[model samples]
Target: MPDLRLDTTDLERAATGLDAVARALAGTDTLAGDGAGDLGHDGAAAALRRFAESSTRRRDELGRAVEEFAGHLRECVSTFDGTERSLAEGLGGAA
Candidate 1:
């Protein structure tokens, strides 16, 4: 269904955004313990913290999007099952 396609697309986009956030977090971690002086350390720590927060938020958003997409998929399966049952019953009655 079109709705399912749209939901899938949205889920993919959210996943991609989360991946980018993860990459940024990894880059920040590389800056740690490099002994770049007090000011440099502070700046790197701040940047790392910001990246961590962004990653957390993006991960949360991705999780919610996955939940929504799964719900939609379940609904679609249930709908198809119901339709198949109804069609089978109709054919049985005719036979």
Candidate 2:
């Protein structure tokens, strides 16, 4: 039961982290564009490239965290199902 709670907490934290990363990426997008067409070509290019790299790394980290959390959720579900089946079988129902 405690383990389940911990897993849930971890999942929540991971989700929050992803949300922060998404917001950061959005902010970067706003900076990457030059609304007045006054951006120096080289500087704009460098800024865009840097933003892209940072966004990519953040996205990858989020993806991995989500995948790990999903795996834990799957395991928990399977365990719960097995326990339910066992209980049903003990109660004389086909588990």
Best by lDDT: 2
Candidate 1 structure, TM-score to reference: 0.55
> Residues 1-95, candidate 1, lDDT per residue (tens digit)?
45422344554566566556555544443233333344456777677667656766665666666566656655665666666668788888421
| Candidate 2 TM-score, C-alpha based | 0.53
Question: What does candidate 2's lDDT look like per residue over 1-95, in tens digits?
Answer: 45432354555566566556555544454433433235557777777767766766776676666666656666665677678779899999975
lDDT of 2 at 29: 41
Candidate 1 deviation (Cα RMSD) = 7.7
**Total colliding residue pairs, candidate 1:** 0
> Once superposed on the true structure, which residue ranges of model 1 sit more than 4 Å away at CA?
1-40, 93-95
Report every candidate's CA lDDT: 0.57, 0.61
Q: What CA root-mean-square deviation does each model show from the true structure?
A: 7.7, 6.2
Model 2, 45: alpha-carbon shift in Å?
A: 1.3
